[model samples]
Target: MLQPKLKSKVRCTDRDIGEVTKVILDPLSHEISHIVVSMNGSGERQIEMAQVQDVMEDRVELRAPASAIAALPLFQRHDYVTTHEVEISHLEDNIDVTPGEVLVPFPDLEKDVKRRTFFMNFTHVIAFLIGLPMAYPILRFLMKPMYMPFDNDWLMVGNVSKIKQDDVGVQFQYMKKVKEAYMPEAEVEKSVWVLKASPEVLDKVYQDKDQEFRDASGRIIWINKKDFPYIAFSGKCPHLGCAFKWRQHKTLGQVFLCPCHLSIYDATGSVLDGPAPRALDALPIRVSAGGDVEIIDMEFKAGVKSQIRII
Candidate 1:
């Protein structure tokens, strides 16, 4: 029985180094008169001293040295030596085993591992330390509170009791704050009213009649209230709080005239002629429980064409 031919397969790192396979023979065996060698994956074939037809089926045929086959580290036994035809077999099928080796290209493993671990740990510590201060300002700003003193804690009223009813000048005491020991304290002063009108006078004063008042300096001071009884507003200009005396315009009827800037106020405390944002402020007062009179709280806001409406 004729022995079956064998083949081997191998992988080479450098393609420039080709492949080889061996056929073991006795000292006096049939001389390899004409041998055929073929590269398997490439399907290229070559013959020594023989034409292509001379080989058995022109496939699975190779002749090479055993030392050349051993040099390739990555190789398969069955792919090494196979006859072109008849009894095509792998070298591993005939032989029990074939040796193998593998090589990989890389730097030293210990140094590479230590470098990577050190860099990662260093970055982690830096991030933790830096994040503490950065978050402090942000947290402080978000958790802080605001300050407001006069939010919904005060009330305002009108002062009309300062005017009298019998047309007689009346005297009243007014209390104002003065510095006491570097702190503010109440100080009293007496102010005298010159003209007094009864509650019924408001109806007549607000009528179509033009009424005006003035101080000793002939400066227009007061204008009679509109559509009311015994109610009137000071003719002081609010822009700079300049006092004005009331005067009857020979042709214009009645007008309050300011001496400092000649600012004028209408009967309703509205700025009739000046650069003020709004009308004069109203004083707060009311009839006392004892049937006398009392002055209450007074506060004001400025606006365009607005007046301190005594209500």
Candidate 2:
């Protein structure tokens, strides 16, 4: 009469193991026979009910230690870390009929029968040989979301006083190290634009601007005069991930213009007019003691109204 919940945390005598993925049951007796726990990505182990020492406080404890459990015959599932050819073999094993198909479809029983008995067909064997090496990188890319850690690292971009008030805005580019899934870190250059609007200009600019940018109580979203007093935004366009520039026009005076698709943004990083879903991404910045501006360089999910940080 055991009822082990799916995905419950499992542990060994010495250390924590993994979560229960599936509970194998004997249908005739309605008894739990095995607990399938995924140790990590691409590795699973089946724990017999006999080895489960206790199942209290929402955790399954094992009789064996972690090292002992790892050495067990059932724990040595194919991770393919030792070899790449195993991944190609796994890809060729997923040709079974899906449950979504109706009327069982027209049976390719002859071909499927050969695959089930021999584990692979001639075509699959040939494909595995031709594409075995490339499958490793593809598998890493597919599993990136599960492996990559979420982190936000701050880097100083530039000094605020260095950008003249008349310059309107300036773009800063810096090297960023991106950690790839199952790969080493990579150095890539990224850019950000700092909009330099002095308190004098901001006083006149937003004095009579849109009331919608403020709360119902009439407090403006863009504070006129703040410390450091420099506005910074990601130079990437929200729509199509294109590089945008700050350009001044005869009537417009100064605006963030996207040359790729003609999206326009105002001084406070609000969408003025264009097909852009949202405004430019404003960065987190602060001023130093000597009137210098230091910015925490980070990126957000592009083409999204609510800015979600992506680092």
Candidate 3:
């Protein structure tokens, strides 16, 4: 029968206090004993049931004078669960709270964000410290494919019929595929001159008095025109790696000539004139039964007579 509603107006004998914010109940008896009144739209004050002279549907009448009502000890409902709240409460009950008695405090975003950033930076530093020593081995492993035997690196050149019989020493460029661990296969492009030639050219004109081009295995490994109809010669000059063109000279016919130093090679890639140290290098080529022309893309040391590995 004595249920009180929130926002019910409360009045002292001389002046109005504002409204009932919450009804205060005795904890042990579970009975409403006092009304919480707000003053000046800010602080809260409580009124005892003994001070309420009359209670109506919309308002409460107090027996105490306005000065006495204002003089009653200030009351602040325990609004905050943290001691860091902007407004500190001055109630005697609030002071007696032990560390174990309080509820969980609300989360603060600024403090949480700072804490997370600190941990993230710490983890990044730890990871870098753990990863630094592995860099050299990783780099060596990544570069190993580039150091693979170039003479054995077979790469696609073109179709077997890509060359026309009438065309004299036609030249083209092609990409050679290089594969490595943990990386996408990469393409390496080089210039090539594809033509039909007799394999005996190496033994006849190119082989020196000492067979300097011959490897220690007694096999003419660099001379690849033996079994295939199509032969490809590296378009790089042995002088200094400058690109050479198949040019029709007034006297020399179609010869591989380097513009950088006037070095020249005949159709069989044998050295003809200029300061070239060795004949043009032959790339090992194969014609598949299906007619796909493939060559082992390789690089050789320039400015030297014998074939040497560059990559």
Candidate 4:
């Protein structure tokens, strides 16, 4: 009986040639016919069993010289076919087995199945490793807003003495610290329009004394006490959130105008003309005894009648 081991060194008569990579067997007889040897530098070749002198535990000695084996044809793998798919004429005559006994003549088929399984598992592992790094940044960026705190703290914007009753609207720019997940804390410039109005003017703009500003979920966001003389409006317009300017119009006189659209507002931040959905958004204000104006800077959803706080 000849037992050929894969990866066994193949030694020619002159020198060591290569190693055995595969053993080809006769399907019916279950006997070895050819062995595929992988050469060190010349690639793989098929060697016939007739040239094999002896098969040992770890090596196979050949009767031919190194030059003769080097000239052999290269080994090629054939496509597999199942026994039930093809008809063999002499399969029964060659086998002398008892009745109701099955014979499995192919051992290399199990090795091929195992190789494919290992390849698939290796591919999945590599794919997971590559995808993990790419997905981390996107997940962090999306969840950053959830972990951030809302800007509800009062920030000192300007002095009340500078905003006079004669002025239509005064623009006050202040530096605010912004928080970002991927970057360090940085200061950004923010601005708001301040208007000084009388008691009658404020009452006309805010008609409903019980009117309340709420968010999208119907939760009350803010309610004016009508105590402060200085009214501060958000720089963003309600119609599409464009920056509005306090300008002198030819027909409308002193009004807040948005250059993007023709949305206009009066000194009380009430929508006077154009496509503005509602009055300009207002923020909570506080006046110190020393005349310092502190206001809570906030943002709201645009193009809606309701005042929905965004941040």
Candidate 5:
């Protein structure tokens, strides 16, 4: 039995011409009659079994020359015909079977290819649908902080009525809701130094001083439209963000003192001495209808001369 495999090298008497692509067989006698050789740069050609001299393990030797093989006619595969009317021997000899053509011997090859293609396409769609729901929540969670509104809401600090006129500075603690990046909103305990002074005393302290309320980028965030007798100063010292307290200084009388750096601020929150670059930060405050003191909780960059709001 002379059986030639596909992809076996087809060599002419002169040199190698091409490779075997198809084995054309005589269906009635179950014998190989012709071989389709795919030539390099020349397309495919059908060679008769009479021109095949030897069929080796990896090559098929032809009895023709390279020039003769090149001169042979190009192979052509005909259309399909019904097996019930056409003879198998005549069909194999006259017509060739190309890709996508259904062969009578292997009827399931074309159907299997189509079924596999449909299954692969359907699998990709199902995988995308399953992954969409899983990806949406993760994307939203990561992007939520960028879309959340800025924290500028006014919070009640203390009652203005309770602060005595002689009070140099009173520290009032309050709970502020803060939302940091990727973290849940939390209530943080914050304190502010509330100073209750008369109009004459306020003028004497802040008379020639220019207090510009600005953010870290130098953009004005708020302006003191109305000057009230009560002033709310951030508990953070203007030098290094250290907590300052009200105490009786040996020379300055009642003053706010930062124990960390000895920065001193008198009853008006003005920098009196030490390495303090500027005055204490004054927060936006308002006297409510019910005599309650409301303030916009804020923070500012430390160590700089300008009052730069941090939050």
Candidate 6:
């Protein structure tokens, strides 16, 4: 019988490993530190890390080892590159090499660089001369984090004593000051009537929880739970801007009625009669310490069922 042949280590080039399976298995016995795969300028594929495995004459059956894929430098791919100092740890197979570690070129990158060489050269000079000077100030102003003051922070109101709980119609003025120039008056105040809900009326509103309101300027309003006591919607009928008012009905007793076009709305600002397109608008309210009232803002006007309003 012939003596059994012992497995011997062999050296090969990337071109020798003809098939993909042999390429993947070449570094099975020896741990694979890195994998280098890139293309050349002529669109030629180069496998730098698999140089030893590539030159194999026949397929070698083996398992794959863990490895890290790395990109090689440009000069290496153009001309033949050499690893000056390769320190491979025999125990762990971790490799540490000099500057010219691997040479795997990517043709796409080479093409892109070649195409934009003219523009890139000019851009680099311009950026170095101009953009670098302004970069520091721009970054400091826009990117730097700044601290904000908390003096204007207000807390949400929770409890208050209820005094008058009846549906009493209330109206307040929302004044906007405008500066007058060539005239004698320095400033003038434009006052707009803002409606508010009474205690009893607000109670019914809380029960129904409707959230629609609007102003004469076709601006819709909404209410928030803050420092408001009661909400008041614009009692104006949108059909013809008629003021919708409330009155005692003959049979319904305390029913709201609009005198302008015979339009009628309920105590909760809902349209009860007439050709009104929607119910009364909703105003926002916040409560005070003693259950007294103040209007933080108004909830814009809206039609019934639909969220569309004259915001």
- Sort order, TM-score high to low: 4, 5, 2, 3, 6, 1
Candidate 4, 65-150: lDDT as tens digits: 99998898775554322233334424434432221221233456554877899999999999989998999998888898766656
- Comparison by lDDT, 2 against 6, better one: 2
215-276 in candidate 5: lDDT tens per residue? 44457665554346677889899899999899888888888999999999887777899999
In terms of TM-score, which candidate is strongest? Answer: 4
Please, what are the lDDT tens digits per residue for candidate 1 over residues 78-119? 333333221322312333212221111122453376788998
User: What lDDT does each candidate get?
Assistant: 0.39, 0.63, 0.66, 0.76, 0.75, 0.40
lDDT of 5: 0.75
Model 2 residue runs over 4 Å out of place are 1-149, 199-228
Best lDDT among the predictions, by candidate number: 4
lDDT of 6 by residue, 183-273 (tens): 3434332211233445555566566454533444445544453223355555455446555554678876665566767777676666677
Extract clashing residue pairs from model 4: none
The true-versus-predicted C-alpha distance at residue 173 of model 6, in Å, is 4.0
User: Per-residue lDDT of 1-311 in model 3, one digit per residue for the tens?
Assistant: 34445667888888887777665544334345677677766567777778888877778888888777777667754432333242222321322223222222233553466689999999999998898798878878878776554345466777767666532566767876655556798987777777765555434433433222233344565454334456677778889999998888889787888999998888777788999999887766677888777766667899888888665
Alpha-carbon TM-score of each model against the true structure? 0.29, 0.45, 0.44, 0.51, 0.49, 0.33
Model 4 Cα RMSD, Å? 18.5
**lDDT minimum window of 10 residues, candidate 6:** 1-10
Model 4: weakest 10-residue lDDT segment is 95-104
lDDT-best of 5 and 6: 5
Ranking by lDDT: 4, 5, 3, 2, 6, 1
The stretch of ten residues in a row with the least summed lDDT in candidate 2 is 97-106
- What's the lDDT for residue 123 in model 5? 99
